[model samples]
Target: MLNIKYDIVGSFLRPSQIKTARAQYANGEISLAELRAVEDEAISDLVEKEAAHGLKFVTDGEFRRRWWHLDWLKEFDGFTTEHLDIERGGVINHIELGYITGKIFYDPDRSHPEIEAYDFLHKEAGKYPGITAKKCISGPNMILVDNYLQLGIKEVPYYGSDVEGLIEDIAIAYQNAIKDLYAHGCRYLQIDDTSWTYMIDEKFLQKVASLGYKKEEVLDWFQRVSTKALEGRPEDMVIATHFCKGNFKGNPLFSGFYDTVAPIISRIPYDGFFVEYDDERSGSFEPWAVLKGSDATFVAGLISTKNPELESLEDLKRRYAEAKAVVGDNIALSPQCGFASVEEGNCIDEETQWKKIDLLVSCKDFI
Candidate 1:
């Protein structure tokens, strides 16, 4: 088994300027050269801040991508954006609120439409000296999940023909993207697969089951897409998967434990797993115990990134003790989810975010 010292899910929140630059460049208002300059400065600042906190692993905060995972697919060669009417999620018991339908392409239309987006983020994060940078990719299964659900997508974007063929092309496109990211020194690539956890919800499960899929078939769907997309990658390099029901609107989509999905997760070859445990909705420690004797490092989500209210030292310690008892000291901790899973910051403001970080540092020894 691979043993690691210290317990840190090291990464940071993205800065705002990168978004501004991407906009200006996309609208043809500024040259790509100008955007690169902005990205360079922004990435440098991001690295410096992460290092200042004494973080061992760092990310560029996904400085180049707009949405965390989807945008990476946009960088693949066979992808094109086409709008299809996809569903929007609700608040609590997060359901499909509505659809902000528009045309989108399935292609990687951003920049360098050859491979994946992670290596570029990794490269940007690498520019900073001395910090071990990380790259986060949208899990291949995530894109397939979005396609299958037709989530938030509008039907007919700029790619007006051959829809079925295009979907197959997308899967192939992602395969190449994953390979390219691996080639570029991405020893620490985290596939952001939050969608899988959302699948265990009763409402959604009922819907998919209505489509004629049984429990075994649905479980196979999860394993097939996830493992196939992750196939043929390097073993020594770490590839971790993260799942939270949903961080939108301070509402969660499902309230179940790893007990439901742990069997599927344990069978996968991923080196580590990160899960949310910040609220009662997340269920109990038994979810992780399923991976007993497994090498996968479980980063328990003991802290909440959505609410500004800080988790007191005592409470966090107690939570960790419980997790340690169940999963042993192999567990690490991170904010329950990304502070900004989408553009809007979580209910928490920037100051509270830093305070939480300070607490994480204070308890480094306990880790």
Candidate 2:
């Protein structure tokens, strides 16, 4: 069984030096090797810090990439990254979205760069005996929403309106990727996903309707695609899914209770779920009742990551109490999302970020 008490949702605030190195590399002022050297140093320090804090699992802080999803997708075949202005939380933000260009395939050799990333994490984590290295990758649902759905059926003629075929290919590619990660000695993997949260938004539903699709039909597609992707993962591998409601700047993309998606989400085969429960925007814990009798654990994100304000311990306990009342005792604690979902990081200082994690750890046994 996974013995996770207090865990992180991956992605920590990027250090200033690492951010500078990335900017310098992007502007051609520094070589890729120089940038990677700086990243390695930063990630090493971050891992040591998390291990020292007693976190059982640690990430590389996603220091080597910009957006969490695009960075992983760029490694796959048939996906190309492009800059676009996306509106999030009523503001326009320039971000990279991976577009589908040709047939999709997850080439292990091409994915070795990340496998090596995990190698570094595993090596660093080795310095702390009790902790394990965890690698977070974007889920197949991202590909469905960003490339296939957003691009439309006509634009990516390779897919040719064959939604089922598209889902199958994505799932197969993901399965191959998962097996490769396990081969590289990665035992803990979290598939970070945000597309599923959009199902609760009326505007998103209207958009789907305009495309001749029903919301339930699209959700059903996500379920099948997500499940198929987990098909051949090793039984020993601890897999978790994080449901993000979009973290950009300090704002959210969509918000609603988990009511709409719970029936479908409850059936996901992941060992645990890291769910967003930070603010009023995320709605109530009532929907999580569906997981009451299942083996799945709910890592309730009762703390916020978008800002620096530390959540009070009493309030945190109260939130867990409410969720536990619905889902029983298979509960865990984490921030609503990653401290930094992108390179910019959240509008919080490093000291404050650690304090938030300290709070989570202190409250591990509260539920």
Candidate 3:
């Protein structure tokens, strides 16, 4: 029974101070304590700013981490990351996580490392009575692809040829993590995923085939794992999933609509969806026909986060009009994605980023 009309995808452009502090910490010039102190102050200021802008939920701006997903990935026990410098857009190259190595599992009684950040965020958000603090984590399916399936690596010496069983362990881990998070007072959680978006793109679909994964089977796998992850959560806990098509230096790795994957996405048990609809690259609202009548809400990402250029309000209204025509009142609005999926951020200043958020908030008046 949670509702929010205007929201964000749970990240903001990292401030210069945070970028500098992280670099200093990496170079051994600063202590972990020093870096965390800087993060605390930046997050405190960020929550206040988000509240002032009329945001119903606030994040730490994801300022304390490097890549949003990798930070959380490392928190789990059985995963190790290798750095692989990958070419993105040919002009901008950055580190991409190589295939993760290890078996994934979780003891249900164990505490999540991320709980500390939520503790801090919950306290900070309490300062603003009506605003909820949101925690965004990488979903189970994304973890499977990022760690094993995409790289064609099998879980060796342990559960080899048992991919389905491995998926069960991942979902159980996700459930344990969610339960722990709710215990720590988190009411809003977003599972950031890119795997579902990959399925809709033709090129990535070919890649999936090349990797020995059938598109239909993988889609069903993603749905089952995602649903299992949300099991046994508190009735009041609000969980949503953000479907992202690779966001690096403001360039999308794939371009396509949700036509092929709509049926599966529509059935995810999460309370809501934060879907990308920024431009034609995301295709038309034809998928809404399938998404209609679901109990879940839809946060149409009509606003763009890839660049600083403001979207024409007229264009957004026109698109929303089409979407609403299909889904009716189950729809809400947000940016297509986070301002920065990683620490480097989109090619926009913090001011431009805030303005993008302001645009989302103000557009609610006319919509």
Candidate 4:
């Protein structure tokens, strides 16, 4: 079993230097190498901060990319993005929709940017003894949702109406990517997914029904695809999935209880689960009983990354105790989600973000 006591959901706020460097690169003011140098320095600094704050695992803060999921998803062979006039936040204002143009596949011969980024992170975090470099990628279900379900496209060029075929291909692509990352020295991997949380919303379920699909089938597909993607994972590699309720511009996109989907989520063969419980919107901790007797570690997200208000230690301890009552002692602590799911980040500032981290570190004894 994984023994991590305190953790993060991955993706920290992008520093100003990295943001400016990206703009300069886009406008042709700086070359790709120059932009990378800036990102390298910023990531190094972020890793140092995470270590200094006493986190056992360190991430590059996902500093190099704009959107948490799209940047990684679009890297695959068959996926593409279409730019739209829509914008998300004030700092970095751009929106794009992803689509599948061809059969999804992972070509091992091609260089993967996320793998390269993990190489840098692994080396940098290696500087501090006992610090594990964690790599966070968008989960396979996100690809299924963004490319097919959300677009209301039941058929594609290659798969046509064969939805199960599409799911299998996505799973295979992820399996290949996971294997590739493992070869690159990634031991701790986290997959961030919002589809499971989206399923909790009635309207989202309605949409699925409107598209001639049953909610139960979609849930089963999510579990099957997730399990298939993790096929052949080494015994030492620890994989976790974070179910986020949407963190954009300090606002949440969905809110409801996890009761309906808890059993389905518990069935996925992940080593750990990063669940959001920062507010009343998440409902009671009763649903966590589904994980009872399971070996998976449960990271209860008690602090809110979307706001600057620090959580009271006593209250946090109380919540953790409540969760432990239902899920047993394999619980860890973390913020509800990443500080920034997008480039603009939540409404909170950097100082506030670190303060929140400090609070999480301070609560390590609860485990």
In each prediction, how many residue pairs overlap at the backbone (N, C-alpha, C within less than 3 A)?
A: 27, 0, 0, 0
How would you encode candidate 4's per-residue C-alpha lDDT over 284-358 as one tens digit per residue?
888888877889988999999987888999999999999999999888888999988888889999999999999
lDDT, each prediction: 0.63, 0.84, 0.81, 0.88
Tens digit of per-residue lDDT, candidate 3, span 1-367: 2387889998888887898999999999999899999999999999999999989889988887778787776766566567766655565465656343456665546655578888999999999988899999988787777755556676543557787877787788788788888888988999898888878888877878887778889888899998888889888899988986888767787778788887787777878888998877877777767757767887899888896789988888888888888876778899999988888888888888888899899887866
Off by over 4 Å in 3: 98-100, 107-111, 155-157
lDDT, candidate 2, 269-365, per-residue tens: 9988899998888888888889887788888888898868889999988888898888877878888899888889888888999998888888966
Clashes of 4: 0
Q: How would the candidate models be sorted by lDDT, starting from the highest?
A: 4, 2, 3, 1
The candidate scoring highest on lDDT is 4
The superposed Cα distance between candidate 4 and the true structure at residue 160, in angstroms, equals 0.6
Lowest-lDDT window of 10 residues in candidate 1? 93-102
Q: Superposing all C-alpha atoms, what RMSD in Å does each candidate have to the true structure?
A: 5.3, 1.7, 1.7, 1.8
lDDT at 89, model 3:
50
Which of 2 and 4 is the better model by TM-score? 4
TM-score of each: 0.80, 0.95, 0.95, 0.97
Q: Which candidate has the highest TM-score of all? A: 4
What's the C-alpha lDDT at position 335 in model 2?
85
lDDT string for model 1 (25-78, tens) is 989999978987787677677667666776667776655554555566555443
